[model samples]
Target: MIYKFCPAVLLLILSFSPGNLFFSETKNVKEIAKVIKTSSETNEEAIYNSLNSNQFALPQLESFKEALKGFYILKEKGLISKNILTLIDFSMSSNSKRLWVIDLTTNTILYNSLVAHGRNTGNEFATSFSNSPQSFKSSLGFYATGEIYSGKHGNSLKLDGLEKGINSNARERAVVIHGAEYVSNSFIQNNKRLGRSLGCPALPLELTDKIIQTIKDKSCLFIYFPSDSYKGASKLIS
Candidate 1:
């Protein structure tokens, strides 16, 4: 005489209801995750091999692996939305194309370009990091992309930091991805490094709009550095 919904019924509905799964059953997100406890090393090797075969740089393989680990952790904790991920490898020189926007569904790189760190971070390399408003330094760890808007820098993408004590002051610091003339090949050729931003991961003017459009809403962004502090303090990755 009455309708009742229990835990098992809810799970069943979540698992088998029509249009419940965003990805196809043949290759779903969880299947790609491979989060088994005993198979961690095996999974890491598979991921590394896959990344290499997909044209990602061999030098950045370690960072790529760490990014995947963070992605899996956040995905399991329900902190991510889409399969697309944007990774900015600050460990590389500013003259290099260290920013990568990857499509996890197809395991391909959609965009690879140069990205700028904070002005106060360094000259040709980003060394120091911060999460304060006036620090004028880049922050490390995972970030969830937010809404897009047209601001002083034309079209900009917002970011919400997900790590405590690592990058949680992103909103207060106003670290959005926007275009700048300094983040270009001309600037790098002239100065031997990409132009620095005011603590924002500024992109080149040509690819700004397209990159922002692709990774704008609910995508994952990981600003990676091999700092001991980040490795120890980042709850999202560590």
Candidate 2:
């Protein structure tokens, strides 16, 4: 008489077959991991595309990509608590609106305003960076937004540098984010460039409070510059 096994039994038998008809546990795990990584990449790509299509200006694609990578890494490490990313593209001229505060959850650009680099960073472009106090040069890398407080700049946001040696001295250097009168279009029009800060990423006076409020409290901030040394040294991005 002919007999048939249930599907479950058949599957069990196939799982032990010499040819390995069914995936081994290791292979299954790897496949699942692959799927998860692919899904994550797809999601990142979607967000990038959405943000790129916005009507307002955006940071350069490469700069945004690096910043996004660091942002997710920081989020994964529990270093960032908010779904906000503030990007200062020091690669662009100070006259340009290179500071972009983006709401990552909504894939929207909340603020795209002019920002000033360090006094020693460069004239029109930020060509120099530092992690030293009194260097008066901006530091490039990832930072975590800290508590808000009123300082000499009125309302300001603190920044805790994430990458050691790259920007870890942010706190000691008093490199906070604040509004400055010289970080405006009018200043640029008159001076041919935005005024430089001591070492802070100063924003337009009108936008300082709002931008700080939106990105403060454990959000990610990335000051991007296409430098080979920084790219290789930054553990968050490298």
Candidate 3:
């Protein structure tokens, strides 16, 4: 005599399989949808006020605004989350390399650093880090990640995103936060010029690691400059 299994019994056996049970339990589409929705609601005006209320000069304030505009554009493109913490201001001046950290939520200056910018190459308009193509051949912009190194260069941060324009290839550059003796208020006073980076946003050796940890891994960072051309070119403002 021949016997055949019922179709209902076969279906019951397949449903009890380990693989099917694991797959059904692990898939949670609702949680993923919530995260994406929350990130989309990030407010732009809030981020702008956070940086503007800091102790920035007129030109620096304008640059900060432009940077905020860029951040807003990124938010719209779903490139960043809404929990923007702070915007750092580097005046890029040899006389005063003042750094200000503005709190986005409360619109206040949380931290301030007397940092240094690139030294004068006998060029007044060459105060920016992007001035000398041989030494620092890149424009001022923002980045996501940075790396700390302790080699012959001492302690320094490897800033990413110099090769690609702002918001492009930022993750690949490996830009990092590290300490540098050259980036200090004393350097500006002694040399009448600030220190220059090979393209990195050099900070005081003391605050390098702290800054790096604070703004690493998808954190928003904006480097400012008083250039109308850059402001015009920024898509966030446009």
Find the candidate with the highest TM-score and give its number.
2
Per-residue CA lDDT of model 1 for 1-238, tens digit only, reads 2333444444544564345454465454354343233256556566566652345454377788788888877776778888878889998999999999888877778888889999999999999999988999999999999999899999999899999878889999999999999999999888888899989999999999999889877888999999887888877656
- Cα-based lDDT for every prediction: 0.82, 0.85, 0.50
Candidate 1: misplaced stretches above 4 Å?
A: 1-38, 52-59
Clashing pairs for model 1 are: none
User: How do the candidates rank by TM-score, highest first?
Assistant: 2, 1, 3
lDDT of 3 by residue, 1-238 (tens): 2323344434544555576556764443344344434433343333443445455442254555656666655655655554353344554444454555554556665556654434332222344444333443234565444455675546555444422444344334333444677767676678666666544445787776666555554445666665566556555554
Please write out the lDDT profile of model 2 over residues 83-198, one tens digit for every residue.
99988898888888888889887888888989889999899988889999989999999999999989998989999999989999999999999989998888888998889999
Ranking by lDDT: 2, 1, 3
Model 3 lDDT at residue 49: 39
State every prediction's TM-score relative to the real structure: 0.81, 0.83, 0.58
RMSD score of candidate 3 (Å): 14.9
